[model samples]
Target chain A: MPHLTLEYTANLGLDADAALLALNHALAGSGLFEEADIKSRAVPLHSFRSGTAATPRAFAHARLALMPGRDAASKRHLADALLAALSAQVSSPGLETQLCVELQEIEADCYAKEYRHG
Target chain B: MPHLTLEYTANLGLDADAALLALNHALAGSGLFEEADIKSRAVPLHSFRSGTAATPRAFAHARLALMPGRDAASKRHLADALLAALSAQVSSPGLETQLCVELQEIEADCYAKEYRHG
Candidate 1:
């Protein structure tokens, strides 16, 4: 029940190669995690801006299958650390940033490889 | 904890308008569900077959935020029904298909509307 997925507007000054590298580093620096069970993906959100549609927004989505035994205290601590790492890496004060973290608590039987023929 | 995300190769016969309509209808026929919390998305996967890499595969991804109160028995019943509906809609017996369902169990503090700037 500790899997987490993070979805945010893309291209928000956070997609640059340099910024992404820094973010990955921050994630690795956190000793509470391992990438063995974590998988993250960044999806692009683009739309047209005509007249009164306000400014455009970008988002990124990260899906993480957290390791087992993550308690309430540990989750909060990890979340705060992640946000801090992201903030330090992004460094864009003018853009409106949004971070949404969802902790997936339940899981059923899932196979790493497709058992179609078997 | 019943949120389910289904991902498969795209461009299968199920992508046809008629097939999708039938699938949605079948989902609605199940009295244990509501569209308010169920959200599904389909992404296409296409690649060229130039050598002995075998035939092409199509997949679909459905993300369903299931309504609460789905117990073990209820989930099994629902999964069977959903699979039956999909099979009935996609009648291509020759096509190799795969069905993977995951139950999302845990959720943390999540706001439908971003509480940014507040």
Candidate 2:
């Protein structure tokens, strides 16, 4: 019952690989996820500029599918940890000048491709 | 713990108001939601033409945040109901042609704006 999707705006300077690695590290060994269940995708957004005063940046949306036993507390912990890891990439941190994080839960039958094949 | 999001490509003929009303009607008396907590935004996408053979159509992505008491079964029912309502707008439906439905879990403190104020 735990599937997390994160939508956030990160600075242009942050390396995608580094950010992804950091996300993986934060999610690793949480005892709440299976080995291959975690799925993620990086979208380099340069066109639709809604937030951050129309700056040309990328919004990386990551989706993590975990095992179905975590409660709200554990989900919040993982989501917060993921955001903290992501925002740490910035040289300076402030409430007004940090990346945004929105997390969501995913259902087991939500993935059509996975469900149809396996 | 019910947060449902539906992202799908509808034909150019579908009216936004009708679609939104259909959504609202489906979730009106679900008994799983707090009235004012349901938030939605209808984006008429015309530029991003990735699916449907590059047709100039809109992709409506709706987000529904419900109370923290509904379980997976209830959540799935709500999500399926929402999609059925959405897809019903189309005159014809087929397996190869339909909008997408993605459901996620929402923690109590996931909404930053809501959490900071109340």
Candidate 3:
């Protein structure tokens, strides 16, 4: 399973849900994962600090959690696509924005889940 | 830098900020990374879907963005501790809750950032 978390700063003029949708679409288009298999969400970062800059700072970083199996090139392509999608959707006029994408390998054996219904 | 993002369902009876603080404290206590170096945040999920259950379902999932270097045992220990910390913090009486922790490796070479002031 691949879970995508897109974190965009509040200062950045970007719609989180819209960006998630677009990025998810782009990822699905990569022919790696099915559209339905991808679970995506947006995290709007409110409180943050960064290096000194003349203008205000903002960022939109996407982290994708992937179960172990994909090769290096496949992941690289996916990450690059996500970054391009973020830059396209999150660019503002005056804010200093940093865009990033990271791929996380989830150890399939160690992963655990249980429903505690109480 | 290791960035921690904790995502808890809206129905979960948890204080987002307090849980973040406690979890960050727990991570720092591990001696793996300094408290100040851990950039932490919480995302309250308003919408989700899960399997059929008699009671309402809720979850608290933590994803840590870690740069590659730590061994398997070290990462496993960190994830287990984080899961325990989450369980201790976010528990409600009636809802079925699932707690999970995921460690993601951020590739050093592929990571890119640009501060754009425009």
Candidate 4:
């Protein structure tokens, strides 16, 4: 299972639910995960400080956790795709926002997942 | 910088703010990140499915993203420490909760960070 998490500053003026949907779509479009196995969520940050003492800015960061063994090129592509999707969906007018996406590999031996549905 | 993210079912009845603090403390205690550079956040999942189609259960998942180069054993230690801290802070009374912690390594060459504080 690949878990994609979006963490954004609350000042962005974007809907968290919409952002989560965009992220899930991006992950699915990347052909990296089954639609049912894709776990996406957005966490809004109300208290955050960014930039220099003179210029405060907003930031959106995404972290994708996938099982290990993906090649570097594939990981890079996933990161770029996710970042682009997030920026398109979350950016607001007249706001300088820094967007970043990091692809992280979850070691299979140390990872555990259990699913229950009712 | 290591970013620790906590994703849990919202029904856990735990204070998200308190859970975040406990996570920050656990990460600092692991001594893998500088106190100033550690980023911790919690996301409460209102809609989630676990186990089979009969037993609806709650789950807490923590993903720790760190810079590449940490050995497997060190990663395991960090995961155990984080899970213990989270379970202690977030578990609900008389609820069946599955707690999982995954350690992920961010590929260094493709990772980027920009900080601005005012």
True-vs-predicted CA distance for residue A46, candidate 2, Å: 9.4
Candidate 2, A78: how far from true, in Å? 22
**Models ranked on DockQ:** 3, 4, 1, 2
Of the candidates numbered 1 and 4, which has the greater lDDT value?
A: 4
Per-chain TM-score (chain B), model 1: 0.57
Q: Give the TM-score of candidate 2.
A: 0.45
Query: How many residue pairs clash in model 4?
Result: 8
Q: Mark the regions of model 1 whose C-alpha exceeds 4 Å error after superposition.
A: A1-39, A44-62, A77-100, A104-118, B1-4, B16-34, B47-69, B91-93, B99-104, B107-118
lDDT of 4 by residue, A1-118 (tens): 6777778898887777677777777777878676666665577788898865756578899888788887888888888888888888875667677899998676786665543332
Q: Interface-residue RMSD per candidate?
A: 9.3, 10.0, 5.5, 5.7
Q: Which is better, 2 or 4, measured by DockQ?
A: 4
On residues B3-97, what C-alpha lDDT tens digit does candidate 2 reach at each position?
A: 44444333434666677767767776676665555555555432222221222223333446554656777767776777777766644222223
Q: After superposition, how far is residue A58 of candidate 1 from its true place, in Å?
A: 13
Give the C-alpha miss distance for residue A3 in model 3, angstroms.
11
Point out where model 3 deviates above 4 Å: A1-6, A11-43, A46-59, A63-99, A103-118, B34-36, B114-118
> What's the true lDDT of residue A70 in model 3?
81
Better candidate by lDDT, 1 or 3:
3
Model 1 TM-score relative to the real fold:
0.49
Residue-level lDDT of model 2, residues A1-118, one tens digit each, is: 2233344454445555456556656666566654233333344444446575744445445565544556889878887887788777644333244465555544555322211111
- TM-score of the B chain in each candidate versus the native B chain: 0.57, 0.65, 0.88, 0.91
Q: What are the per-residue Cα lDDT tens digits for candidate 4 across B35-92?
A: 9899888878864443222333567788787898877787777777887787777656
lDDT of 1 at B16: 38
Relative to the true structure, candidate 1 has a C-alpha RMSD (angstroms) of 8.9
The candidate maximizing lDDT is 3
Q: fnat, candidate 3?
A: 0.32
B1-118: candidate 1 lDDT, tens digit per residue: 1233334454456543343344445455565644322222333345523246566444344444543566888767666766665556553455555554444444453212221231
